[model samples]
Target: MEATLPAVAEELLREIKKAFQETSHVPDELLLALKFIFGSSAVAALDLVDQHSVSRVVSPSGRAVYQVLGSSGKVYTCYAACHFCTCPAFAFSVLRKNDSLLCKHLLAVYLSQAAGVCQELSVSDQHLASILLEEEEG
Candidate 1:
């Protein structure tokens, strides 16, 4: 079946925003690409996250918990959290680049945090599995 670009783009934008809200850094080029692909809608969503201080958290086994701030001010809790963005663009890039290149979520989060979009968080990872598992279930 032929996929709708707008629908796909919308999904991509949501995932990117989710990832950004939960991660610390997003790549610059990826953000630009999102803007190019999704335009103002994507930017507006990102702006909301930034305004709200949403954060992403990640906890990989045997690593410290990482708290990531999104460009839109959303916060994610965990260690190595970008692994969870759920954005097609990010998934494609990770699959195509073998995780070598940074994804758009990472770029957006980085820019957002740098701009003081939200508060900083430092947490431990032993409890991160629950967070990751929760996402998996959704």
Candidate 2:
């Protein structure tokens, strides 16, 4: 079956977000990633994280998801590799214009992974459920 880029991208995005949210305490790797995205001080990045704005989430299948919590309490999945975000800023400002700009959420995930903060979570029946569901639904 042909891989739907969005789904695959979502899977990757989920994992990255999950790592940040669920990983054992925030490590230097994650902080480093934030620095890259938010700049050397990393104050803004920490602020976002401290506020629980950016986090890792669990999908219905039990897979870890990378998500950014909006001010409105809307959680958006993020795909750093594809520079995609399921948020209004992305959908309206970027997608509507057919632009290829990366949102802050995407940048955070990318920098976190690149800095070695996030990791590929181990697959489990509970977590794998989401992955399977995605395959079935998509």
Candidate 3:
């Protein structure tokens, strides 16, 4: 069986998207321009990332693996330890580039995990096993 994300996860993604769309992802140069105008400290691009877009799901027994849906509406299975995502962005940017960089899905997962916004769910052992197998086979 497939592991499922909660309704809260989708809602949170929407909220994160909305919040992120406004005054977000401004590069440091833009921040520098703003700072010059306002005489304030410059903000970095990383500061604008919305960590709340991702929602993590765990089994009640803490043994299931869950997939995350991205802002593009695609499901990406992520392996935390490897800093990997099944998304094309990871394959092209991180894996192909031979670096530890992350795609948006992986970044969201990491950020959400850090912010404690990942949602945990109850799933069967098979669900977790299937996810792991898919990762391996993929």
Candidate 4:
């Protein structure tokens, strides 16, 4: 049976709270960002489950792809201009922040990409890519 939206949402919230409670080295900026994202009902909706997957794939142009499997058993694909996550949290994060990182959806994607288990994982986002580039340059 599929999980209801509220159930998934509540589960996600527990995970976020547990993550926050267990972290000792979290940066102030990250903590603030977490509070801002998880603090809101809309954003909180994204953290409702613990089961998911992430994978990476190479593009024709030689770029990495990222895929996310949401707790609701939905898949989201994001590659450059074609980014989509199965969870509403991903969209909520983007819509809520003009310039912020460390959202739960992004975290999920990053974890999935890092784990190398996503399908057709060749996905990228300009916004995320630019951040990586900036970090490299800095």
Best by lDDT: 2
Provide the overall lDDT of each model, using Cα atoms, as 2-decimal numbers: 0.48, 0.53, 0.52, 0.45
Cα TM-score of candidate 1: 0.38
Cα distance off (Å), candidate 4, residue 34 = 7.2
Q: Put down candidate 1 lDDT per residue, 20-103, tens digits, no spaces.
A: 666745567667776776455346546644664435443344443334444444444422343335444445665665532334
lDDT of candidate 3 over 1-138, digit per residue (tens): 433333543444344444445644434554344344323111211232242445455655675343667656666787665556787867886678753344656545644543445676666667667767777887
User: Cα miss at 72, model 3 (Å)?
Assistant: 2.2
* Residue-level lDDT tens digits of model 4 in 29-94: 544554655454223323422344555545445666454555557645444323344345555664
TM-scores, all candidates, are 0.38, 0.43, 0.54, 0.37
lDDT by residue (1-138, candidate 2, tens digit) is 322334533454345466656764556665555454334324533444446466555544554657665556665677543556776666765589754345556555554553355434455666556644553454
Residue pairs in candidate 3 whose N, alpha carbon or C atoms collide under 3 angstroms: 56-118, 56-119
Off by over 4 Å in 1: 1-38, 56-84, 87-108
Poorest 10 consecutive residues by lDDT, candidate 3:
40-49
**How many Å off is the CA of 76 in candidate 4?**
0.7
How many pairs of residues collide in each model?
A: 34, 12, 2, 15
Model 1 residue 71 CA deviation in Å: 13
Better of 2 and 3 by TM-score: 3
CA lDDT, candidate 1, residue 9: 47
lDDT of 4 at 132: 44
